[model samples]
Target: MLEFFNDTQTIHFIIIVGSMSLFFIGFYGIATQKNLVKILVSFDIMESALFLFFIGLHYKVGLVAPILDKHLKTFTNMVDPVPQAMILTTIVIGLAVLALGLSFGIEYYKLTGRNDISKMNELRD
Candidate 1:
């Protein structure tokens, strides 16, 4: 059990499975939820799952952060910083999009006095 838990492959497998599960949960929520807020939340959940999958997959067991110092001058053993940076940028963009979506939802709710997707027929004309 100890050996199994300590294996890098096992860790990666767990991350992949966990992220996939989260993504599907989000997808299910989006598919079944009638409320606009719930759908937006589901979208956020899916985004989070993708972020987790990317970051988790890029991680290595024995790698250090990509930093330069006297003790570690080379970039050889350091973990790749590109994925982390990309995830950070993605997080910012995701937040902006989520905020925009929520603002639209709020406006729609204000105009219609309801937040249910099924009842949103204002744009059907």
Candidate 2:
């Protein structure tokens, strides 16, 4: 089962399908989920999927961690570190955005005593 993905002929296809699946599932949740928190989580899932795809792209047969030390590393070599940095930044930003969104969600719940948007009829004319 897993051996097919290891084959060079199908690695790219596997990565594409897996990453697209993750993205599509996240997109579906964003489009269909009603709860504010659920939507935010879906966005996070999408972000994670992108990061996974990035790391998967540079993945080699036996790559070592890109640590700058005196040692010569290992049998293979290092991929790239830019994606790691970008993913770290993205995860932090995502946390900040999620926190802000949750704060707004809490405020809405407090003001209306409800979590569903359909029931939020206080501001409607």
Candidate 3:
């Protein structure tokens, strides 16, 4: 039983399920919340779920980071670098988008003194 938990496949499954739950939680928050800030928080949560799933899916047991050293002369059993690189790039982009979204929210709040989506219909004009 202990060995089953120790297996990479089992760990991946757990991670997937956990992330999926988080995704649903985020979706619920986005769907039910009326506050703009809460919606943004939910969006972040959803983004985090995707990141968790991607990282978990790429993880392998007993694999080392993709770094070159004398002790690690071969690529065998080394973690793939592509996903890490892609995720790092994605994180930067995500931050930029989040910052832009927050700035928009701040501007909207400043202009109308409201942070609820229902009250921001004036934005259409």
Better of 1 and 2 by lDDT: 1
Worst 10 residues of 3 by lDDT: 116-125
Please, what is the TM-score per model?
0.92, 0.81, 0.91
Over the stretch 6-123, how does candidate 3's per-residue lDDT look in tens digits? 8898999999899999999999999999988899899999989998888888888988888879887877888878878888899899989999999999998999898888766774
Better of 1 and 2 by TM-score: 1
The lDDT-based order of candidates, best leading, equals 1, 3, 2
| Among all candidates shown, the one with the greatest TM-score | 1
Error of 2 at 48 (Å): 1.3
lDDT value, residue 88 of candidate 2: 81
Candidate 3: where is the Cα deviation over 4 Å? 123-125
Any runs in candidate 1 off by more than 4 Å, and if so which? Answer: none
The Cα local distance difference test for each model comes to: 0.92, 0.81, 0.89
Give me the overall lDDT of model 3: 0.89
Q: CA lDDT of 45 in candidate 2?
A: 87
Give the better candidate number (1 or 3) by TM-score: 1
lDDT of 2: 0.81
Best by lDDT: 1
Candidate 2 residues lying further than 4 Å off, grouped into runs, are: 1-4, 68-76
Q: What is the C-alpha RMSD of each candidate to the true structure, in Å?
A: 1.4, 2.8, 1.6
